[model samples]
Target: MNILKTTALVALMGSIAIPAMAEQRVLKLFTDASDPAPKAAFEQLVKGFEAENPDVKVEVNTFDHEGYKTAIRNFLTADSPDLANWYAGNRMAPFVNAGQFTDVSDVWEENGLKDSLGSALKSMTIDGKQWGVPYTYYQWGIYYNKDVYKKAGVEVPKTWDEFISNCKKFQEMGVDCLTTGTKALWPAAGIFDYLDLRTNGYDFHMKLTSGEIPWTDDRVKAVFAEWKKVLPYTTKNVAAIDWQDAVSNIVQGKAANYVMGNFAVATFKDGGMTNDTLGFMDFPTINPDIPRAEEAPTDTIHIPAGAKNKADAKKFLAYVAKADVQTKMNEELGQLPINKNSSVGDDPYLQAGFKILSTADGGIAQFFDRDAPAQMAKAGMEGFQEFMAYPDHLDAILERLEKVRQRVYKN
Candidate 1:
């Protein structure tokens, strides 16, 4: 009788423990943060979230950055994860419109993100509702050679006219004043983005990219006319060489400035340029009357509409949204955090980026390629490249782009 009682007690304990273990919720996370730094950053977030919610087991599915772009379209419709990583600005619009992503505005309001992540609030929002939480971003500006400026005997330019005038000095010395390789086509769009933002401001620029304004509008012509002023001083072989080749020109002092993202700082350093030699600054102001805006491409995270564990996924979003969490994550990724209260690392370039982006009251713009639809971004950039090579063809290029604009945004 005693042996039978002990056996029954052991069986009862097994049944009790199994149900308790089964109570733990599993949250699926799909991400393109497969690169070492980004992967580690997500791991930090996951670990942090798990620490706070011990009953939630996070299951992560990592994908290559490029491949995930295509994979997400299928997964979001078929087998959606509880959460996924995506880009900010117009890049996320398609998923949002298709009802693949959940509206997380409540999360933003409840967590007080309106104050802490104000800089990124505009980008992460669509139709007056927040869709995701932004975590990391990097600045885009004129990465110039200080040594080249000294060599040209000209001061750093503060206004668009001054920059154009300085280009003449660089031309006189037979050096390219502004060098960017457009073999990949996208680099030319950066120049156009700064030109439009400076000439027209952020709202107008966003309208232009969204196909609300005709590509051949008078304002568009004005932007190209500004481009003409410095055309004589840019790299002659811009259409033939890639961006990396132009980096060599900047490093060799064969070129003066390259309008590029902060990531190029690493390549510039690898090419034997130091912080002293490689100077970073905001893109020279084109219209002093217009408030200054800055370009800072941001990466974000969101909950899928079909998420099975919406509760736990929201908890993850709120966790990553914290200032301390972002500060640590961005530090690991060597990028700037989007949180207003987050502290940047010791890198001078990152620090400068933080200052300029934080102070950009005019607006924060994602890159041209990001703010436009994929097809439109491709066609628009192609037009930008052709315009750089043949300024006389501006009328033709604008008309072609206007047609693409109508077709792309007809919906």
Candidate 2:
């Protein structure tokens, strides 16, 4: 009888002890911040979070950007992470609909995130339910080598005519005017999107993404025409190389300019150039009639519904939302902080990007990949790569993209 009683007591005590003691939960985080500079910044922030909460452990499992997308889809369907990095806009809609992510509306309100994140970015929150918190954002624009420009004696182009003239000057200097890679399709898609923005303005970009306009719209054709005008200035090998390799062409002085996101700053620095050696500018206006616009979107962090430590994850999310944390993130990573109150430093390259992002006449539109559904964006971008290779097939590319748009958006 005593043995039985003791055994019951022991089991009860074990249960109570386990609840009282420190519990560790592994947080699987999938992110595209794979580069050393951003990785170091994330580690530093995670360390701070770990220090504050001794009982909680965050295990960040990062993958390459493309790999993360595939892995996240697999993981979310089964064995999803406690937290992860995802894009805002239509990108999150499917996951949210499937209940893969937690609805943190209350947490968002309690943390004052609605007030913290700007109105332009508030679209990230869907149907009055907050989905994620954005950490950082960088403007996409033209990055030019000042040395190359100086040698060609050409100023940064502001208008379509000026831009073409500058390209001629660079060609005369025996240099490729634009350094881009269609091997990945994104760089080429970016050029296309920026051209569309410069042609039809931001509203049209949104309408097109939302399926309010067809892929074969004349405005889109006009944008493609502008792209054709500039294509001769692009490296002949753009079809054969990736964005990184194309960027390498610029870094090696084989090309004069690269139109890319500010994230490429790290790659450029790695290739050895200071702010004095580099110049940044908005995509020159293709339509003199249209107003200037901006394409800036936040990189969001969200807690998956299956997170083992929801409370702890929320705490970490809140920690990153602090302005000081944002400043540290931006300063170290050289990207713009999502916190509007935070001031980006005096780097000329960053300043130029900021000028483009801050002073735009319209709301910031997320990148093409983020603004549109991922599957659709993928198909569209691939078609863009094909079009870059054979501009005459623009009609076929648009037809395929229209099919993808119909399938993805169902309109």
Candidate 3:
């Protein structure tokens, strides 16, 4: 009987100890960094975070870029993760207003992030409170094929007139001057945003996007007029293709230039184009009187208000906000780190982007879709896509978009 009692006690102790051993402090992270490089960088970050905090386990759930856009809305409200990757600016505003995202001001103060994040802090802040921390951002500009430019004997344009002239020259050489994919719609909005920023200035662009200004306003019309000048030079049937397909045209030398964010540089490199063969230039000066503002969309990470592990999520946020962490992750991402002290390395494209954005006197706009409400942004980008395919429908497009703006903003 004594031997049997001892055996039973040992079995009970084993069962109890196993549950204790398996109970780890889990930090659930949902990320949309599906690209190989960014996915790897995130994994590396999680590894480091786990190593530093041995008692905590981080469970990361990654989704494809497009799918995550839809999935985040569902998961954020239903089964909230400890952290999730998202965009700053207006894209984050809804979540902030809904009280879905946690206010990470404490993390910022604890880590002295204001000094580290610099200008990027503006995009992450909503109503005097910081919603999230931006880790990386890249500039949008004209990316051209040097070989194609050489074939056409046209130099990079510096002014608006020069840009138009160069497009004419490329046409004369029997080469398409510009190419873009509007199938996803957002690419067209990017072009519209740049033109608006160049022609009407950043403040006006913000007002227009935020529904403070009507889409049918003359300032908005002027932006479309400027865009019209370049449409003739763009690839035909752009609505049928996506951004990657348009990028292939530039890579294959079917087109001379593309207006895109710096992230597209990776696509170019993968298409077998060398850095020396590709050239990066700022979007030419349209309104030289307007101080140069840039479309520098920042990607951010946030702790959800419904997070099960707020303390651990804050720890991860603080870890990511560090300069060293930003540097490493951006090195993997091949993009500019938001931390002012982080190195951008020897990538010429990144260096140029860094210089342009860091020196932008007029500040930055977080791309059209990011800076505008989702409902309005969707209709606006679709209108842009329609306008690209049928410029004559500009008025109709603007009217339709204006209706969406009114409904969405209740203006």
Best by lDDT: 1
lDDT of every predicted structure (CA atoms):
0.91, 0.78, 0.88
- RMSD per candidate (Å) reads 2.2, 5.8, 4.7
Displacement of the residue 41 alpha carbon in candidate 1, Å: 1.5
Question: Please, what are the lDDT tens digits per residue for candidate 1 over residues 263-381?
Answer: 99989999999988999888888888897888889999999999999988888999999999999999889999888888997788999998888777677789998999889999999
In model 2, where is the ten-residue run with the lowest total lDDT? 114-123
Report the C-alpha lDDT of model 3 over 202-241, residue by residue, as the tens digit: 7788778778999889888998899999889989999999
lDDT preference between candidates 2 and 3, better one: 3
Top candidate, metric TM-score: 1
Ranking by lDDT: 1, 3, 2
Q: Cα deviation in Å at residue 147, candidate 3?
A: 3.1
Model 2 clash number: 0
Judged by whole-model lDDT over C-alpha atoms, candidate 1 comes out at: 0.91
Candidate 3, which segments miss by more than 4 Å at Cα? 1-26, 33-36, 54-71, 74-79, 151-153, 240-245, 252-254, 266-272, 289-291, 361-363, 373-375
How far is 390's C-alpha from truth in model 3 (Å)?
3.4
In model 2, pairs of residues that clash are none
Estimate the TM-score of every prediction: 0.94, 0.75, 0.82
Q: Which 10 residues in a row give candidate 1 its minimum summed lDDT?
A: 355-364
Estimate, for each residue in 150-178, the C-alpha lDDT of model 2 and write its tens digit. Answer: 88888888887798888888898778998
